[model samples]
Target: MNHAVEPIELARDCEAIAIPGGETVTLPKGTAAFLTQSLGGS
Candidate 1:
């Protein structure tokens, strides 16, 4: 469950899939991502 707001900053370019279309995309460095939950080996 999400309790605290997790703030993450990308250290380098990372390839990720676009959720809606499932398209492969690259997340540039310094990008921000918030994690509410983590599962598996993420």
Candidate 2:
């Protein structure tokens, strides 16, 4: 016997979010500036 499976499709408006360590924060437009000021740029 043979079996077939259908592929799943994702919606266009779908979005993903990561919540690591249970801390939620927002980064402003000046993200590079903030990082440089705090941890220095790479």
Candidate 3:
């Protein structure tokens, strides 16, 4: 017997998750600043 690792595209195709309505969610200034710092300004 053999097994193969699935590609990311395949995995994403098989999975589903819910997203909120708005394109962007408003967060408090403090929270936004913290996230920006954590993500290195993305």
Candidate 4:
């Protein structure tokens, strides 16, 4: 059997911004995030 992995695309470019005395999180433009688990059957 063949499995497929889907990725989530970013809508726009994310800029690196400083949080309220917290660490900054940066995600580049057109970032793709894949699903870690399979939802069809567990």
Best by lDDT: 1
Residues 1-42 of candidate 2 have per-residue lDDT tens digits of 223354334323333333456555444432331111125454
Query: Please, what is the TM-score per model?
Result: 0.64, 0.23, 0.18, 0.32
Q: Which pairs in model 4 have colliding backbones?
A: none
Instruction: Judge candidate 2 at residue 13 and give its lDDT.
Output: 31
Clashing pairs in 3: none
Q: What is the lDDT of candidate 3?
A: 0.28
The window of 10 residues in a row where model 4 has the poorest summed lDDT is 33-42
RMSD of each: 4.2, 18.4, 16.9, 9.0
Task: Show where candidate 2 strays beyond 4 Å.
Answer: 1-20, 33-42
The order by descending lDDT is: 1, 4, 2, 3
How many residue pairs clash in each candidate at the backbone level?
A: 0, 0, 0, 0
Better model by TM-score: candidate 1 vs candidate 4: 1
Report the CA-based lDDT of candidate 1 relative to the real structure: 0.79
Reference-based lDDT, each prediction: 0.79, 0.34, 0.28, 0.60
lDDT of 4 by residue, 1-42 (tens): 344377777777665545456667777768985434335763
Which residue pairs clash in candidate 1? none
Candidate 1, residues 1-42, lDDT tens digits: the string is 564476699899988888679999999999987655556773
Task: Give candidate 4's TM-score.
Answer: 0.32
